[model samples]
Target chain A: MNAIEIKNLVKTYKGGVKALKGVDLCVAQGDFFALLGANGAGKTTLIGILTGLVNKTGGQVKIFGNDIDVDFEGAKKSIGVVPQEFNFHMFERVQDIVVNQAGYFGIDDSIAVRDSEGILKRVGLWEKRRAIARTLSGGMKRRLMIARGLIHHPRMLILDEPTAGVDVELRHGMWEYLRHINAQGTTILLTTHYLEEVEQMCRNCAIIKEGEIVLLDNVRHLLTRMPQDTYRVTLKERISLEKAQAFNAVKVDDHTLDIEIKKREELNEVILRLAQSGFVITDFHPKGNRLEKLFLEIVSK
Target chain B: MKREYYIALKTILRKETTRILRIWTQTLLPPLITQTLYFVIFGKFIGSQVRSINGIGYMAFIVPGLVMMAVISSAYGNVVASFYGAKFQRNIEEILVSPTPDWVVITGYVLGGIVRGVLVGVLVFAVSLCFAHPMVTHAWAVVLFTLLSSILFSLAALINGIFARNFDEVAFFQNFILTPLIYLGGVFYSIHSLPKVWQEISLYNPLVYMVNGFRYGFFGFSDVDPGVCLLILLGLTVVLTCINLFLFKKGIGLKN
Candidate 1:
């Protein structure tokens, strides 16, 4: 039972801007899927089509086996989307926004109240439930969107840039909440620029480029495919350019060097060469995240 | 599934009603003050000098028309502002992405307009009672005409909101089209008082039938045939509703 299946999806905007050429992808039931793409790679358009916000030029979309064209309501009922933009009413109170969303799903008043409270509390917005939505901070607003998107207990949740503006602390909290819900069997389709988030949360990953899925595989498998890792090394003192050039390290500055290491290369060999050359390593870190490295590798290819 | 639409309708109704009440100063107060001014200036100050038109007290003659005008504006304004506000803020996507049907969304917004229109109409009518001893010759006719007129304007406003891209577009329809039609619809003076040439032109305005039909319900007298007026109103309501539904189905100016 796939949570979502899109086949040959096409979308050409009004002025002939081809947003999606022919995107095909699938997210297994209860899987946390990460959809990574560049700015104009049609990630938002794909999510818009799935949520019925954008009319597709061609292709088929199914949610939990219900075809969108054949059973529009059924397909819609199975999914909830948190769009990239803040689309909820700004004048309404935080509680009404979530409760009203539940109402649209045919949840009764009592249940709506209970669920709204539960979700609001989970999102740490219970205390501010009576406040107008616009008065809340940016992170709180993002959490409110999450609460509203989950009020109906959708089988699949699509979040587009959900943590774009969130701080590190709040982002971690939101990630925990998302993991909790996903653990409870809600399939989450997350689109994010934060590759670290995808590494931390998503099990299966798909990278879309130019409106098409160019890579789709398990997160670990994709990371394992990377043949080399780049690291930024800080030295105690500046080494001669010739000494660094012998190891083919790029001198970033007087005391810093950028080094690339193959997966099977011995770290001691590189460090020993620097050591023998009178260079003492002070600090070292990967230049980029593993997923990010792979993402850049695949997209650039 | 059977309960889905009903629940959505109820939720939307509650939200819209809350919205209407939340901003009472903006939504309700302006119409009350505006209509009251009309009664005092047009019905008392100028109406005294004019005496009576069509053998009825001038104040009483304009009461139905004034109330009808309020109904049209309030109903139309409520839906137009509310729906366009939804569009402007992009919050309409909440319902657009849900399982709620398009008809349910239309009905919810139309009913919101109707509620505001009817409430304003009744309030104006109550205010009219202080100025003129207006009597309802057919209570059912008054209710029927008021409901029909509200529905008509509500649907019209929905159409306007759907086509409107910005606040200026919404105001353009109201000021250029709606306000002018209402004025020429014979709110202050009876069309019969005008020269036969202008009277002939007035007949082309659909609002004349709505105003006359409502006036007929109050005094059992009308400038046009009340039966014809009712049929015309019914026909227009059907047409506007069909057009609105078609727009929603096509997602015009809504989905992209």
Candidate 2:
């Protein structure tokens, strides 16, 4: 069974702004899925509809096979959402926020307390349990939100821009923690602008543009779809364009060359040609993340 | 009640009570001080001049009215500020995303207001005791009116909270609408003392019945029949609760 299935979902704001235009999506059980979109691409709107924060204009959403309209409580119980913005009360204590969130799921106070402590400790926030949420640093606050979202032990979790403003060091640890959680069998739907995170963590991905799904496939397949990768190599000696033509390499200048490695061609073959042609290669690396290049192409198109 | 519903209600109630208790200076102390000033200035100092009203000492005459006023304001203020504050801070989304039903959410908030309103009412009643020794002729009547009044005003406050967009909007309702209605509700004087037309107009004001019913409970002297007052309070409560439930189910002011 699918963890989540959204069918012909629609949302039109009060002022005639159609945030979503009949988007249909599905996530398999226990899959680490990425929902990629630019700002205003209706990603948040879709999340809002799923979580009951935004009323849908039309269509159906189901979580763990329960229709949201027919069995809202059942659907709600199956999924937890970590919103893009900090939505918990700022004046509330960290521990209280997590426990109170559990309470909404009808967890008993004693159980909520024990579970809150466990989740907070896992997020490295147990020591700051007594502090008001506003007093926590940005990274700690984000962790608190994650702890709150997980308190109910929902079958599925949705994270919207989970690492938008996090520092590199904190983001690294957060990514590891998220990967650990996903590995534990919680189906996660992540929406992040960071393509590198998608490349590293997501097994399946869907890119939405202007409220419609433009691309959907496995990460590996999407990477394979990119026809070629551009490599920048520093040469040991200057080579004429004519001399580099046999290898399909472009001469940037003295001691520099840009080579496009097609899908059917191997980088080793290029290196072998350079060696036999009496040209030495000093440095070689892809210009950037290959997935990022593909992402840019799709978004720009 | 379902166990889950019970837990959710208890959790929300605990949070709200803690909030009110945490800011005792703002929620409890201000009402105590304000009611004390009203007792000293209006009941003692001014009552000494007027001597008796409706065959009772003026101080005693105003006790039940003043108590009802406190109950009304505190109950309405608690829910309005708490709910609207939740909205302003976007913390209401916490519950909106949960499996808790909309009715439970409304009940939780209204129950919080009732608790605070009754607490403040009791405190104000204790303060009134120092000024006058007004006896409760029917204890159940007093309790019933107080409870119903709190429920009625709390429901109204929830409606106000739903419609309010900012702090200024909240203050606008409190200052322009709620306060005026209370003052004109015969809190300080008997509507019977007014000119015939004004007395008739006072009948149109809903606050008058609430205060009158509460006064009837204390002294058995009421401008309107206590039964009529009870009926109006119950009817308003039902209608307002329906409106609140509709708003929640329709996702007005709560969902985008």
Candidate 3:
């Protein structure tokens, strides 16, 4: 069964702003799926409809095979949501915020208290349990929301940009924790602008463009479809601009070269040509994330 | 109600009660201080010179009205401010996204208001004891009026909270509407003392019945029959609760 099944989803705001126009997609159970969209691309609106925050003009949404319109309570109880914004009360204590969220799901106080300790510790916020939400830093606040979302132990965890502004260390820590949970058969649905995170974490992804699903494919297959690859090479010796322009190269400095190659064969050809030019390559790396380039191309269409 | 939904209601009430106690200075103390001032100035300092009405001292005559005033304001203020705060902070999404039904959510907030309203009412009545000894002639009427009136006001406050876009909107309803109606509800003096037309006009104000019915419970003296007042309170409670439930079901104010 799919974790989420959206059929003909549509949302038009009061002023006739069409946020989602007949979007159809599904995420398989236990899959780490990514929904990639630019700002105002209706990602949040889709999540809102799923979580019952926004009313849907037309759609049939199901979670774990339960239709939201028919069995909304069942669907709601099956998934836990971490919204993009800091939505918890600012004056509430960190521990209370998490436990109270569990209470709304009808979890007993004693059990919520028991689960909050593990979740807060996993999110690296146990020490700050007594602190007020407003006093926490930006990243800690996000983590608090994560802890609150996970308190109910929902089958599916839908995160809307959960780690957008978090530091690298904490972001990686969250990634590891998410991976651990996913391995335990918890389906993860994520929406984020960080294409690198998508590449590193998501197994399957759908790119939504202007309320439509433009692409739905495995992340690996999507990466394989990149028509061109760009690389930056550190050269052992300086190469003349005239010689460097063969592979559509741009000179970073005297000894550094940025190049875009059309095919894998072209890379070898460029390397042979560079070796022939009496310059050896010291280091080489991709200039940009592969998914980002594809996402830009898809969204701009 | 489902067992789980009952648990959710208890959680909301627990949170609200904690907030009421945690900010005692704002929620509990201010009402006591304000009612204390009202008792001192209106009941003790001034009522000594005024003649008795209905064979009862003027101080005792105003006790039920004072107590009712506190109950109405506290009940209205608690729900409006608490629900509005949840909206302003956007934390209300926590409950909206949960499996809890809309009715449970509404009942939870209304019950919270009742807790605060009754606490303030009891405290104000206790304070009134020092200035005037208003005996409770009917225990059942006291319980029913206090609970029902607070329920009505709490439901009204939720409606206001839904329509309010800012703090000013919240305060406007309390000040321009609720406060004036409460004062004109015969809190300080009997509506019978007013001219016949004014007494008739005062009957149109809903608070008049609530205040007088609650007073009837205390001193067994009221301008309107206690039965009629109770029927009005009961009818209003039913109609307002239906309106609130309809608003929640339709997602008016709280949802898109």
- In order, the Cα lDDT scores of the candidates are 0.92, 0.91, 0.91
iRMSD in angstroms, per model: 0.7, 0.6, 0.8
Clashing pairs in 3: none
Query: Candidate 2: what lDDT?
Result: 0.91
- Per-residue C-alpha lDDT of model 3 across residues B184-204, encoded as one tens digit per residue: 999999998999999999999
Off by over 4 Å in 2: A234-258, A273-283
What is model 1's DockQ versus the real complex?
Answer: 0.87
DockQ values per model: 0.87, 0.87, 0.86
Score candidate 3 by lDDT. Answer: 0.91
Fraction of the reference Cα-Cα interface contacts (below 8 Å) that each candidate reproduces: 0.89, 0.90, 0.82
lDDT of 2 by residue, A1-301 (tens): 8998999998999999998998999999899999998899999999898888999999889889999989999899888889999989998999999999999999999999999888999999999999999999999999999999999998889999999999999899888988998899999999999998999899999999889999999998998999999899888988887886766878888788888999999789988988898878899988778888887788899
Docking class of 2: high
Score every model by TM-score. Answer: 0.96, 0.96, 0.98
Question: What are the per-model C-alpha RMSD values against the true structure?
Answer: 1.8, 2.0, 1.4
Report the error of model 2 at residue B81, Å: 1.0
Point to the candidate with the largest TM-score. Answer: 3
